[model samples]
Target: MGLNAPLVSPRPSDGYDHRFTEVDYLRGMERLVHAVQELSLARSLSDIQRIVRTSARELIGCDGTTFVLRDDGICYYADEDAIAPLWKGGRFPMTTCISGWVMLNRAAVVIPDIYADARIPHAAYRPTFVHSLVMVPIRTLEPVGAIGAYWAQERAATSREVSLLQALADSTSIAMENVRIYAELEQRVRDRTADLERANEEIHQMSLTDDLTGLTNRRGFYLLGESALRAARRNNHHCLLAYIDVDGLKRVNDELGHDAGDSLIADVSEVLRTMLRESDILARIGGDEFCVLVTEPGGDTARLKDRLAEAFRTFNTTQARPYRLSASVGLALTHPESSHTLDELLTLADELMYADKKAATESRAGGVNTG
Candidate 1:
């Protein structure tokens, strides 16, 4: 906690303090450069999650790491890269989750003695290997997510560790924001091109677009998406199916009015359009919900996910709307080698989407620990 402590290396899991020399700084900076490069090209939330956890684990030297997303009054464990499995897909109430604590407070938190910390739910901690931890919100102003680093023994996260983790968080925020911007620009160009092709105007007008946003409607999605999947199977191509739910739609409707909510839907559609190819199928399956079927040449499951995250990130930045737009996306991919049916893919995608949505919702809560 000293002024110079942050400049020192993090405490190792062996309960020994490590000294950071000039060489370590150079190595750390080098590692960070690689992290940024990978993150910049990462087009999916999982990619971002993986990169964050791996980089933090290496730089902070923690025994375990996790990436959490807030959804619907809960903190959902979206991904993890740890010495032992902690909460990969479990849901925790905001008050009980340290990651949630960071998001709600919009600040970083370090608990050297998690058992002694009243903020931590002791019962939950009793089963985990984590005796100490550090958590940082992905963004400071209006944070959308958080990252957690855990230690197997009682140890303090040095100032240097906290600063390093925060830096990574800031970098992640920028990567997410850029994804949003790219998707927006890409959508605008597509819209303009479609406008120029006047020959198809009448057919498109009568087509299956949602009345509010121009995305394909539920019927259109099922019809078109199923066909696309069938084609992928025939051609032996891989496919990615994603279910997306817009975050805070109810809040936007309540705080900003119905018209604003409608705008949010339209803007999010633009994001979806940008993330996929002209060949891919996208549909507005429900109010504040979208489904994307992607399995085209030069596209894989990982690439589709990366682009999806970019769309959400880009929308949050470029759209000058009163409310910030974000989404919880669950993606399920069908391998060219697997004989998975469209119905099977649908069930998986829907279940994953709800799981992610639940996490985002719980992370936004303000009440007592809902353990």
Candidate 2:
């Protein structure tokens, strides 16, 4: 008979000793101990497959072994270590395969004669040397896969061999569970980190922004204004600092409600945004005070003042309100190659703004409306 032909040895009824010797038991135990250690360190499914494929065969003294995974209703023979090829990278229907039966039943099976057993598809074994086999589920509760050991002759699988194979499958199941848990933990940490970064960025933006006017606050002005001043000085360019205070804000707040004062401030901020170029740095530094830093050389202060007066005139003519919108403006110009600091320029602008406010108040002493 050919080597692949059915080689059915008589069963234990013929008094043949089918069990391995005590020395073989010791060797199997030694290999199993080492396999458990390796499995404990496995990080992925492929790692488990690699460690189990060879270790299972050595531990059970099988002619061939296969690591099978249950892919939905399909049984996939993913890896194998054998004397000859035994269905590596092959797929079969879960209902028609022995490994699938083991996984679906969540138990182990030991087949002594491939041709006699109804569970074994006899036609599938005709091309191979497999005559007997032992299949065990990876997990007894909810089986994920199965480990199979095949022999070239008919021999009843001893209880010890089945136990050893089942132990290996249990370890593999634990390793796979660990891999899943580790992946979930890693994803959760990444998600939390992204959330924290977004929150921190929002907090930073809130710290530098004025809540009422939606403009830069005093801290932001100093931070960005210093950078602009340094750049202007390095280029030897003339820069201007303009300080403006809204007129009659306190009077409006005292007469009308604070809501009207807030609306007036918002309107003033909108007017300043419309008058200034996009590159100009504008900030609300106090309750009724605003500042602008123009870094470019040759800014026209007279034209800017004229545009502000015209805009206020148009607004007062169009809007019906208890008080008109007006502001006292003062400017401090730093010449090219000047050594004036940003704080010094702001102080100078504040002094000039107070002087302009005094002049306007005196001019209104002739019974003329100032706002």
Candidate 3:
């Protein structure tokens, strides 16, 4: 029974009650409290390992220490610290390992002979200097991991020694629990924060865009048009502001219903989109009013107006819609030498649009295209 016998015990309540003196007991308690307190500050699994491994190896007067955790149904030899090399990164199954037996039984075992115990595999200890050891389940309730203290020479483990190791195991359980809870909380906050950012982005996009046509609304027009104006002014370029009104939006709304009016607005937007370059700014400013900022150095407003009119004519002739679509456009130009602001430029375009509307009303085009 030299170094292969099993001695199972329930710790401090075990048969070796008279082992510790009053002074030694108090000193051990003080050290145990300090160690357990430090475990709370450990933020990671590695931190927990470093704290437990060093403390167990030193406080228990052992040559080495190990922290074996259970993963799935297998016992994982997760970590260790020793004066000599130990099983720091090896794994063992629950069926044949001593650490597994203690964990499986949810009990503590002090082995004076590693070769003698049925649970101990002979070949496993042949390479190491661990002749005897004490292993304790991390939790008495539901064990997650185990802590082991290994001795170089065969010796009977004192009741005090096994008790301290059990205490360390229990402390580790609490420390790991704290780390798990903290990690879960951090992940949840991160996920929630990401969700909020996405929602805010969607809201901001909605604010800048018109719900009907998926086009830039008045607010978006002002913001983007201002930036385009600044760039044009800096680069000594020409900028065109076009004020447009759908020719028969109200009549279409009255005759064909609001849905037809909406369809007409979308069709007009498509024609306007095709008339401008990618760098141009187009926005639906009001019910049937739109604005455009052409950003080229020498843009042709006449050509753009003609193209939109032609596109509308082509679309109206090709598609059999309830009503034809047409637009009355007004153009105002801003160059580098111009002293007018964006608001003044837009006002000038609107005035030109009203003048065009007045002229068209006076012409004999049916009952005077009334405003």
Candidate 4:
């Protein structure tokens, strides 16, 4: 290349090479602005590498450019844009490489002849096209890396070339810092999003559950029961809802205190849980009143009722409690296609439960009279 080739603009009418002229200076400024813009938009280390390697060479009109990172005790030639391959993807000790020296010294160096410079590792440069070079630290006060511009022939880099290289290196440092900031910000957003999701799920579960028995509450029953009914209607299936009221709850609460009454309710909940299948939806709909909705097509209400009676008998026989446990259960069976809503079924079940309580009271009175 000619003396003015690197910085010359197009020839004017006078056929003069306009190097170091106002036109050439404006063009250099334009290229530098474009490079800085590219660096500002870089999102990662690799992005910085790609932009720097290409833009540095273009701005300085060098034969090659390498972006070298200072890795702990080593100088890593991370990326390069060159006429031929430089030491890309290679690592050297901090004391052995020119790029490392630039970073350590926190200053730029212009080497006209690599052989003559005592800092140059002559054996290392013997086979390469690099003979003269200008290397600038990325950050001056505390350097993180270096950018090197290389030439195949021995030539002194002008002051303008060194300044341009340093400016680009400074921008590279800022771009790298921005990448770190963006990564941390993204991680925090992900963590906050996860925390919110967990909180929402816990709140949702609390709304649907009974505080004392840990069973599904009335609100849950209606929400889930309505959905189940809708599915049954679509599939032409049947549903059986059993409303169970704990017998003599008022007496237990009054005589033994609300604490014993609570124990009784919890015991009954356990019995129901033991007797019911995993698919059964059991809920504590009211104080001492529990409801079970069986949506399975093959469910037998009679068998379910028998199981409940047996479960209660087993609980009373096994536990030494002040009060005996018993429940009045009423089952309302219906096809969803009949247009019977869950509310209607629950109302019907409640009435049947009252009738069942009446029958049990009458049977006990009759037994006492006979005795």
Clashing pairs in 2: none
Q: Which ranking of candidates, highest lDDT first?
A: 2, 4, 3, 1
Q: What is the lDDT of residue 252 in candidate 4?
A: 92
lDDT against true structure, model 2: 0.84
Query: Whole-model lDDT for model 4 versus the true structure?
Result: 0.83
Per-residue lDDT of 274-349 in model 4, one digit per residue for the tens?
Answer: 8788877899999989999888646576776777777777777778999888888888888756788899999998
Error of 2 at 57 (Å): 5.6
In Å, residue 3's CA in model 4 sits off its true spot by 20
**Regions of candidate 3 where Cα sits further than 4 Å from its true position:** 1-28, 121-127, 231-238, 270-279, 336-339, 355-371
User: RMSD to native for every prediction?
Assistant: 27.9, 7.3, 6.1, 6.5
Model 2 lDDT per residue over 185-238, tens place:
988999999999999998987888899999999999999999999988888887
lDDT of 3 by residue, 269-290 (tens): 8877876788989999999999
Worst 10 residues of 1 by lDDT: 362-371
Residue pairs with backbone overlap in model 4: none
> In lDDT terms, which candidate is top?
2
Off by over 4 Å in 1: 1-25, 187-371
Q: lDDT at 12 for candidate 3?
A: 51
TM-score of predicted model 2?
0.67
**Candidate 4 local lDDT, residue 242:** 92
